[model samples]
Target: MSLIVRVAARGDGITADGRHAASAAPGDTLTDTGEVIPGPHHQPPPCRHFPECGGCQLQHLDDDSYAAFVADRIATALAAQGIEADLRPTALSPPRTRRRATLHAEGGLIGFTEQASHRIVDMRECHVLHPALFVLVGPLRALVQRLRPKGRVELHLTLADQGVDLLVKATLPPGLAAAEAITAFAQAHALARLSIDEGYGPEARWEPQPVTVTLGGTPVALPSAAFLQATAEGEAALVAAVREATAGAATVADLFAGLGTFALALPAKVYAAEGARDAHLALKAASAQRPLFTEHRDLFRRPLTVAELDRFDAIVLDPPRAGAREQIAKIEAAKTPRLAYVSCNPSSFARDAKALCEGGWRLDWVQPVGQFRWSTHVELAARFSR
Candidate 1:
């Protein structure tokens, strides 16, 4: 028998003697013929849809092993770039804490899609969704049957300041009669807002009040289409890390600042730049009372040049999965003293980190944030100084 040494970046288990085993955790025993025997680090998955549901991947790993997985992912990525830092303890968000999610609907069923397939799981019970969000699953199932959505439909559910904000995107446009049914569903569910997209854009069908998401003690108007961190706990951890990384900087630049997640949280005179019109407008309106400036600039097309990058004491970048390749190159050229980078993709982040380190910047530390609990998807905040 061989011992499962570690979990791979793609959620598979690797044995010491060069073998991959599915559904096996660290410390598990692997038989010669490929039977996985659970060990100390292995535990029963909390969700009934384990190994089938695509929403979560590491549910079988205990908390300790799961935290190790989060840390190891970052370590592995940094190692590839010939870089290392003070890897801090990983912050694991508790189960049932996810406040924002995208669920699929088909054939009167509502749930996450299956792993590596187009099929839906038709979730009967979920362990990762918050109590408030999961409460509407049954109602949503019935509503889908009534609406009879043609083709695949996507339901974007987010917990706004008022209540659950739901956006339904379906192939069939809502007719006048369907509008009535949608309104009724929204009202019955006490939803904060509801919108529908028919390939055009999201049009609000029901909104009793303007939906806003409170960040940094200010309520920023959450546009129908906006991005937010997966879980509140994860957001808190990331915010704390960024704040610590950029502490004492009087002037800061928040690039790709979606709804001022890090810009508003920092007390410095922040110059927040965002590409999306709604997000830029919302951040401008929300931070009118604070020492913050807003700019609707697309970093991908036109990154801040070295001359422009030298205007801040520190910069905070929270780029998308693609990472901020262009911005990092500018940073390399500029004389910016420090920066705190928040990234959702480790491989992309590692590439950026390599450039930063090669440019004479020092990687101080890294803090991993596993917001999507039991999932292989990882996020982190890091500090770099020159």
Candidate 2:
């Protein structure tokens, strides 16, 4: 028998001899015949959809082992880039804390897609979603039934200050009858807001009051399909790390600033730039009274040049999964004195870190964040100083 050693980047278990096993957890043993024997770190998955639903992949791992796996992912990414830094302890978000998620509705079922398949898992219970968000699953299913939506429908749910904000993308257009049913459903559930996308952009069907999400201690109007951190705890962890990294800076540039996650939180005079129009406007409106400057610019298409970047005392950027390659190039050229990088994908982060390091910046430390718990996803906040 071979012992399962670690979980790979895609959630598959790797054995001692380097063979991958599906649905195997660390400490589990694989027989020569390919049967898996559960070990100490293995536990019964809390969700019945486990091993089938694509929502979670590491639920079989114990708490300690799961945390280790999350840290290892970051370590491996840095190692690949030949970049070493002091790695802080991994911060794992507790279950039932996920504030935003996208579920699929198709074939009379609504839930996450099945692992390695396009079929929906038809979620009966979700351990990761906040109770507020999960409670609407049944109501949404009922609404789908009433509307009899054809083909596949995508549902995006996020917890706002008022309540759950839902956006539905349906293949079939909602007629008068379907629209009435959606409105009734939203009213019955007391939803904060409900919108549907029928080829065009999302059109609000019900909104009793304004929908907003409080970020950096301020309430910003929530826009449909706007970017947000997955969990509140995870967002707090990242914010704390960023604050520590850029403490005492008088001026800070927040590139790729989505709705002012770091811009509004930082004490410095912030200059926030984002490509998304809605997010930029939301941040601008929320930061009108604060010492924050918001700009609607595409960083990738036209990254802030060295001259433009030199105006800030410190830089903090949270780019998408692809990482801020273009912006990091400018930052490298500028030799920014201080930088705090928040990333959801470690591979791209490491790649960018190498560029910064080669440009004479030191990779100080990284705070690993396991926001999407029980999954291969890894996020981190790192400090770079020249």
Candidate 3:
């Protein structure tokens, strides 16, 4: 049996918009009070769903508040590990700049899963998607409505430089004719690019061709499967932050350099290391000044040793959410001269930053970049010097 709990106004660690910690009450069910209204220094609520959706927890927080939260989170994490530094809030992105998304579609209807529920919510207007995506929502919905598949569906959209990429996934009934219907619907509606992934249907291999996205008027074409910043404006700001962090460094190492994003623009000779084969190929294609070397190694599994650190004067690491515990250990043992760590996971970054500090590296600055807007997620660029 579920119990209902009425929020008792706002209190410590709670917000004016009724966001509170979950506690068990006698018999009252929790009353959802709409989307959360973001507080000061936070990003505005982009979606009507707001805090309810697992997708974005920081939506109700306004841009300024959100930026502060990000910085503070990192600072708190670092403090726990005895690393102190000045943390700066980076720029936030404009609303609705999501270039790509993977929405869950079920019962032939395209939608997102409800918060913490397998049940789907029919999304009418997604405020975080690109403007071009907003324009295609009605038609896209209608197309899905027409081809009602049996089970769940996955809709992936990518706004490349030239056009949009739509990849639809579903389990089909024994006799559903989705390919022709989907193709006709796309053609009639003038969809930029439509692909289908019917795990068990006749037209199973339909895939959209990749396209380019011009950022700040600079054409950056990436594969659809490649990692991309959620927001264009946020990406530009991050690029600027990376440039600022690496400015004047003669030689730098970009660990886990996906597509050589920072490496391409940096003044230093970057020794880029990436784990993904596709990312390495993408970096090779994107980078102009062939880095001193590009190596394919899983830094997470087999980390760089202190001997490796002796080679580069400076190091910039951008590892995934799991954090770079192994790599950080090696860096510390090596006593690398300078270190710049870019991270998306605050908790992990905090832990790693502490290790660096204990190893005699000073935390110069922690810059928080709001790359994933309207979400609890934050991207950070932390500089540490020996």
- Predicted structure with the largest TM-score when compared to the true one: 1
Better of 2 and 3 by lDDT: 2
Instruction: Looking at model 3, report the run of 10 residues with the lowest lDDT sum.
Output: 3-12
- Which residue segments of model 1 deviate by more than 4 Å? 173-175
Residue 182 error, candidate 2, Å: 1.1
Taking all chains together, the TM-score of candidate 3 against the true structure is: 0.80
Candidate 2 at 60: error in angstroms?
0.4
Summarize candidate 3's per-residue lDDT along 248-363 as a digit string, tens digits: 78888889887666776677787889998877776665564455467788998888888877787788888999899989889887756787788888789888887877788888
Local accuracy by lDDT, each model: 0.93, 0.90, 0.66
TM-score of each: 0.98, 0.97, 0.80
Q: At residue 294, what lDDT does model 2 achieve?
A: 89
**What tens digits encode model 2's per-residue C-alpha lDDT throughout 1-386?**
89999989988889978988887889899999988899888888899889789999989888888888888898999999998889999999999999999999876689999988999999899999999999988878777876777788999999999998999998655468777788888898888999988879999989999899999899999998678999999999999999999999999999999898899899889999999999999999999899998899999999999999899899998999999899988999895699999999999999999999999899999999999989888999999999
Task: Supply candidate 3's per-residue lDDT for 227.
Answer: 77
What lDDT tens digits, residue by residue, belong to model 1 across residues 140-222?
98888887878888999999999999999896545787778899999998999999988899999899989999998899999
